[model samples]
Target: MKLNILSGLIAAALLVSGAARAATQLITEEEAKLPPPKGAVATDRRGILRGPKVEFVSPGDSVSSPMRLQLKFESFGGAKIDPESVKVIFLRTPNVDLTPRVKPFVQADGINMQDAELPPGDYTMRVDIKDSDGRPGTAIFTLKVAPK
Candidate 1:
């Protein structure tokens, strides 16, 4: 019984370490300083299937580093959200693609990032998602991170 308990404890430790290793830098300080690309337009258009609704659930307009970032996606017209179609873009000069970094936390309902590390600054992010019907939706918001 003692050996079994030890094995379980070891397995738990490995899982925690693996999760820590999977954490990616959401945005770097240098990358955030880049100027926005010329004519970089981010627009939302209505579709026949009705786009999904994206909601920012935490870390309001202002927050600190290593914060929890949660977003909820709501679909309409009997359509479901397509997790694979999610896109996260940091609205900066030559926009930074954050989709890959946040992919692990994405789901059909939304994204729940437990540890989003960012430098102190004002940042704007554009979240784009599509429904199972192929209808697109987008949400743009600004986040201000206070200096530590």
Candidate 2:
């Protein structure tokens, strides 16, 4: 029994360490390349607007409650878009244009959230992508964050 218990503990450790995990093809900002899905878009008084293709997948790309509304962006022409020039907004109020945001990461990809953390109710996610000159570009999407 002691040996069996020790063996189970060791297996759990390996799984959590990600050592036993196989290589995963990270969805690059480019491969995140899927045409933006539906969601909300808007601009704040500061004049920041979200891209048209902004979207979400899963928080951490896994199954869980209170799942995160991820954001996806793409620029096929004119000016190329990157993550830094983007922003996310989550709110409880409606019809009011506000700056939705998080700490913009230099190396962050699409947004995500587990299912449990987000409370059930009406919610909205907004995304904005900026041009090279630091002006808002043309892109937008909107979606309702509700019960799973």
- How many pairs of residues collide in each model? 2, 23
* Model 1 error, position 41 (Å): 4.6
> lDDT per model, in order?
0.86, 0.42
As a TM-score, model 1 comes out at 0.82
Model 2, C-alpha of 75: deviation from truth (Å): 1.2
Q: Tell me the tens digit of each residue's lDDT in model 1 across 72-99.
A: 9999999999999999999877789999
TM-scores for every predicted model: 0.82, 0.41
Q: The CA-based lDDT of model 1 is what?
A: 0.86
Kindly give the stretch of ten consecutive residues in candidate 2 with the minimal lDDT sum.
23-32
Cα lDDT tens digits, model 2, 55-131, are 45444323323344445554433555655666544332333222332432222344442212333333344556664
Which residue pairs in candidate 1 have backbone atoms (N, alpha carbon, C) closer than 3 angstroms, thus clashing?
35-93, 36-93
